[model samples]
Target: MATYAIGDLQGCYAELQSLLERICFDPTQDKLWLVGDLVNRGPGSLEVLRFVRSLGDSAITVLGNHDLHLLAVAAGLAKLHRGDTLDQLLNAPDCDELLHWLRQQRLLHAEENYVLVHAGLLPSWTVEQARGLAHEVESALRSDDYAEFFAQMYGNAPIAWSSELSGYQRLRVITNACTRMRICTPQGEMEFKFKGEVSKIPAGYLPWFEVPDRASRDATIVVGHWSALGLKVTPNLIALDTGCLWGGPMTAIRLDDRRLFQVGCNTPVAKDW
Candidate 1:
């Protein structure tokens, strides 16, 4: 059985199906590692959620920023942004079930020598540390006071990781690092605004994976948030957000051989934002 790690779907169900077919995916034998952002922006979010949820054990997905936003909106803690295409999903008959399943999903998934996260980990966090921190957020997401968690979830404050951080601040740091970060200082301080290409990164900030002596650098960190960074593959990193929602192809890579498989986007979402 082979395992494939795919980029962000962002509600591109047709391309996901096309890519799976291109890879000749066999649900019974093949495993899928999805980089999250399973819904939003593009069309077919409801169908995508249902299909992926139907896969059960065949698929493993980490939660993305969009996924968390959906939960917050559903819980009445946040409002949908201007370009969000989540109305159908929010009104779906199984919306509650889907959101529950999504809340229980991991923030970071580590197996063997690879780590799967929607975004990047902080430079100071080892894979094990990251795993534990992820659980903290996961527990809050699954807790009885989950709405409280969502209520305090949005913000860019406390821009760096610290052991002294407590309560929602701590969980917020973990959540942001795992679901929204793109670039950071060598000191592990995150900058959330810049989402452009590598060369355009602001002074003193570099891609999280490029930070010197990153504690998690030894493991192959598979991430998908930076669509501008595109499809980058290296010895210890695989950055695969190919902007499928912005007219790019949906991308996937076989872990065994590192072979790439892509399917063109037929109905691209307007990049109005």
Candidate 2:
């Protein structure tokens, strides 16, 4: 059986279908690894959610920032933002079930020598440490106090990590690092504002994948949060966000051979937003 790691779907249902067809994906024998952000900002969030949900155990999806935002909005802890493309999902009768499934998904998933996360991991964490930290957020999201957790989720507090951190501060840091991080200063300071190409990182900041002497460098990391980075495949890192929701192609990579399958977008993204 083969495993395929796909970039952010971002509600691009037709592109996802076409990519699957191009790869001849076999749900019966092959597994699909999604880097999450399964919905939002594209034309078919509902369809994407429904089809992936129908896949059941055949697909392993981790949580992306957009996915968490959906959960928060559904929980009445947040509001639909200007560019959010989740109205159908917000009004769906099965919204609760969908949100539950989304919350139950882990922030990081690793098997054999491959690791899948919606975004990057801090340089400080080994794969095991990242997984453990991910579980902390997953537990809070799945707990009945999830709404309470949402209430405390908006900050960048406890901005640095240490072994001694505990409670919401710890969980928020972990969540931000996994779901929203792109660049950080060597001192582990997050630079959330920069969204340019690799060459554009500020003097003191480094891409998480480029962090010197990263503990998890031995493991292949497949992630999909930075559309600005596009579809990049290096020896140990695979970036799958190809700006699918921004008039670019939706991307997918075959795990066994690293072959790429992509579909172009017809309409431009709602760029004005």
Candidate 3:
């Protein structure tokens, strides 16, 4: 059974289907590792969510920022952003079921020597510690007061990790780092505003994976979120948001042998956001 780790889908259902065809994915024999953003932006948010949820145990998807935003909007804690294409999804009959499943999805997934997170882990967090921290946020997401968590989920403050952080502050930092982060200081202070190429990653910060002696550096990390960073593959890092929504190819990598399969985007959404 092969495992294929795919880039962000952001509601690109046609492209996802094409990429799956290219890989000849079989739900019974092959497992999928999806780097979230399963819904939003493109035209088929509802279709994407429904298809992924249908995969059940054959797929493991870590929550991306867009996925979280969908939940937040569903709960009335957030508004639909300008480029959001979630109306069809929110109006669907199984909206509640799909949102519930999406909410219950992990913020980080770890197995063997591979750690799958939607974005990056802080430099100070060991794989074990990161898993524990992820559980904290996951618990809130699954709890009765999850809407409250989403209400406080949006922010750029605290900017760094601390063992002393508590409440939503703690959860927010963990969520941001794992879902939205691209560049951060060596000290793990994140910068959320810069979403450009590595050459223009501001003055003091570097890509989170480039941090020296990162505690979770021992394991291979599969992440998306930073489409500008493109499909980066190294010994311990696999960054796979190939900007499919922006007309780039939807990419998938077979984890066992690092073989890649891609399909060109069929519908390119305007880069308005």
Candidate 4:
């Protein structure tokens, strides 16, 4: 049985299938790890969700920013933003089941040597600390108190991590770090506004992975969410969002050999949309 880590499906079910077939995926034996964004933006969010959910114990997924956005919108905590293609998911017969399943999914999943998160972790957080903080959010989402948690999930307030953070503010910071962070100030505060390539990193901000003495640097962190950052495979990091929904290739990394596999996607450009 092999293990594979796939990039953002972003509703690209066709590409997702092709990539799985290329690797000869056997749901009964192999493990499929998705870096999330399993819905939205691409052409077939519903199919993607259904397929992954059907995989049962063979699959693991972390929540990407888009995934959380779908939950927030479905829960009425946020609006359906422009260009979102999540309407079908929001209205599906299995919508409630899907949303509940997603809420129960972990923010961080780890194996012996790799930890998977939808986005990067703060350099300050050890793997155990990140998992514990993730559980705080998961507990709230999985509880009857979830609506209260969703109500306070928005905003860039408390833009940094602190052990003293409590309540919704703490949950917000954990959610942002695992799902939306890209660049951050040297002081460990997140920069939520800058969405450019690495070269254009704003003053006082550096990519989360670039910070010195990062706690997670000791083990590989499999992550997506930074499509602009593209597919980067280093000894310690695997940045696998290859912009497949934006006409790039769907990417998969073989865990046993650390080899890369990809299938080109000719998704329509925004002009054609």
Candidate 5:
């Protein structure tokens, strides 16, 4: 059985199907590792959500920023953004069931020698710590009063991490680090403004994965959400988001062999928002 790690779907359902066909994926035997952001930005979001939800146990997805935004918007906690293409999904007959499944998804997934997250982890967070923090968010997301969690989940404050941090502050830091992070200072404080290619690397900041002495460095990290970083693979890091929603391709990597598979976007181009 093979395990494949897919990049952000971002509502590109046709591209996902095309990529799966290219891989000749056998759901009965192969497993899917999705890096989240499964909906938003492109057409076919409803279709994408329905198909991924149908995968059931064969699919594993972590929560991405956009995914969390969908949750908040659904609860009337947040408004739809200018570029959001989630209306079809919000109005789908299976909206509640699909969103329920999405909320139950984890923020981090670990197996063998790898950790899967929609974004990267704090450099201070070892794999063990990453798992625990992710569980904290998972618990909040799955709780009956998760609406309260969403209400407090939108800020970028407490950008720094601290084991001593508690309540929504702790959960928000963990959530931002795992879902919205791209760059950070050496001290593991997240930078929310920069989203261009690595050539435009911000002064005094490093890509989240490049932080020296990262505690999770021992484990290979599979990540998405930084489309500008574009299909980077190193001995320890694999970046799969290749800008599918920006007129680029959707990518998937076979975890066991490091084999790569991709399909160009079938949707119209959308410039970065």
Candidate 6:
């Protein structure tokens, strides 16, 4: 069985289908791991959500920042932004079932020596520690009091990770690192202001993957945020966003052999997201 890790799907379901066809994905024998942002921005968020949810055990998806935003908006904790395209998903007949399934998805998924997260991990967290921390957020998200966690999930405070952290502070940092982070200090302090190209990544903040001695570096990480970094494949890091929501190409890579599969995308760019 083959497993293909795909980039952010941001509502471009047609492109995803084309890419799947080009890769000759046999859902019966092959598996798919989507790096998240499964819905939003593009026109087909609803369709993408339904198709992926229908995949059952054959597909796995980590939650992206956008995915979390949709949940927050659905719970009335957050408002839709200017270019947001998630209304259809929120109004779908199966919206509750879909969102519930999405909320149960992990912030980090590790298998076959590869760790997949929607974004990047802090330099201080080992893969095991990250998984434990991810479980913390997951537990709360799946609990009866999940709305309480989403209430505090939108902030950027506690912008650094600490094993000693507790309560919402601890959960906040874990969420930020796994979903919203791009650049941060070597000490793991995040910089949320810059979302531009890597060439202009500001000062003092290095891309999370480039942080010195990142503990998770011991294992390969597959991430799908930072479209500006485009598609990067190194021995230990795979960045797969590729700006597909902005009329770029949707990307997928076969995890076993690193074979690339891509299809052109034509969705209009909607801001920096």
Query: What C-alpha lDDT do the candidate models reach, one value each?
Result: 0.95, 0.88, 0.95, 0.90, 0.93, 0.91
Q: Using lDDT as the measure, what is the rank order of every candidate, best first?
A: 1, 3, 5, 6, 4, 2
Local accuracy of candidate 1 as per-residue lDDT tens digits, 13-105: 999999999999999999999998999998888999999999999999999999999999999999989999999999989999999999989
Per-model TM-score on C-alpha atoms: 0.99, 0.97, 0.99, 0.97, 0.98, 0.98
Residue pairs with clashing backbones, model 2: none
Model 4 stretches with alpha carbons more than 4 Å out? 269-273
- Worst lDDT window (10 residues) for model 2? 264-273
Instruction: Report the Cα lDDT for residue 18, model 1.
Output: 96
The parts of candidate 1 lying over 4 Å away from their true place are none
Off by over 4 Å in 3: none
RMSD of 3: 0.6
lDDT of 2 at 229: 86
Could you tally the backbone clashes for each prediction? Answer: 0, 0, 0, 0, 0, 0
CA displacement after TM-score superposition, residue 143 of candidate 5 (Å): 0.4
State the TM-score for model 4: 0.97
Q: Candidate 2 has what TM-score? A: 0.97
Model 5: residues with Cα > 4 Å off, grouped in runs = none
lDDT of 6 by residue, 112-165 (tens): 689999999999888998899999999999999998898998788998877788
Question: In terms of TM-score, which candidate is stronger, 2 or 6?
Answer: 6
Lowest-sum lDDT 10-residue window in model 4: 264-273
